[model samples]
Target: MSRTAAQFKLRMPAALRAQVEQAAKEARRSLNAEIVLRLEASFAQVKQEVSQ
Candidate 1:
C-alpha cells in the first residue's frame, strides 16, 4: 500500500466542536492537529498510569 497520513471521519456534538475550534485557534493549530495532540497526551497519561 502507498504510504500516507491516515484519514478518518469523526462526529461530535456542536458544542464540543465549537470548543475544539476555539482551542485550535488559540493554539494556532489546525483542528486536526489539536485532536492528534490531545490523543497523544491521552495515551501518554494512560501509559503513566499503567507504570505507576
Candidate 2:
C-alpha cells in the first residue's frame, strides 16, 4: 500500500534528541527515518505481545 507523508513539529528533551542523533548516525539513516524505524519496531513489539 502507498502512504502519504505528514509533517509535524515534535518537542523533545535535549538529551533524548542527542541519543536519537547518535543512533541515527550509527544506523546510517536520516533522523526522520530513524524515528520512523523505531516507532514501527515498537508497534511490532506491542502487537507480538498482544498476540501471545
Candidate 3:
C-alpha cells in the first residue's frame, strides 16, 4: 500500500504514553511509527465494523 506522509501532534495520558513507549521498544520501532501503526489498525477495525 502507498503511504501518505504527514505530521501531526497528539496528546495522550501519561499512562498511555508509557504503554506506547514500552511497545515501541519491544517492537524495535520509533515512538512515532508505533503510534501510527496503532492508529492505522484502529481505523481498519472501525472500517470493517462499519462495513459489516
lDDT of 3 by residue, 1-52 (tens): 2257766688989999999999999999989889889999999999999999
lDDT string, candidate 2, 4-49, tens digits:
7777899999999999999999999988888999999999999999
Winning model by TM-score: 2
- What is the alpha-carbon lDDT for the whole of candidate 2? 0.90
Which window of 10 residues has the lowest lDDT sum in candidate 2?
1-10
Candidate 1 matches the true fold with a TM-score of: 0.89
Candidate 2, residue 8: Cα displacement in angstroms equals: 0.4
TM-score, each model? 0.89, 0.90, 0.79
Better of 1 and 2 by TM-score: 2
Off by over 4 Å in 3: 1-4
Candidate 2 C-alpha error for residue 37, in Å: 0.3
lDDT of each: 0.90, 0.90, 0.91
lDDT, candidate 1, at 44: 100
lDDT at position 20, candidate 1:
92
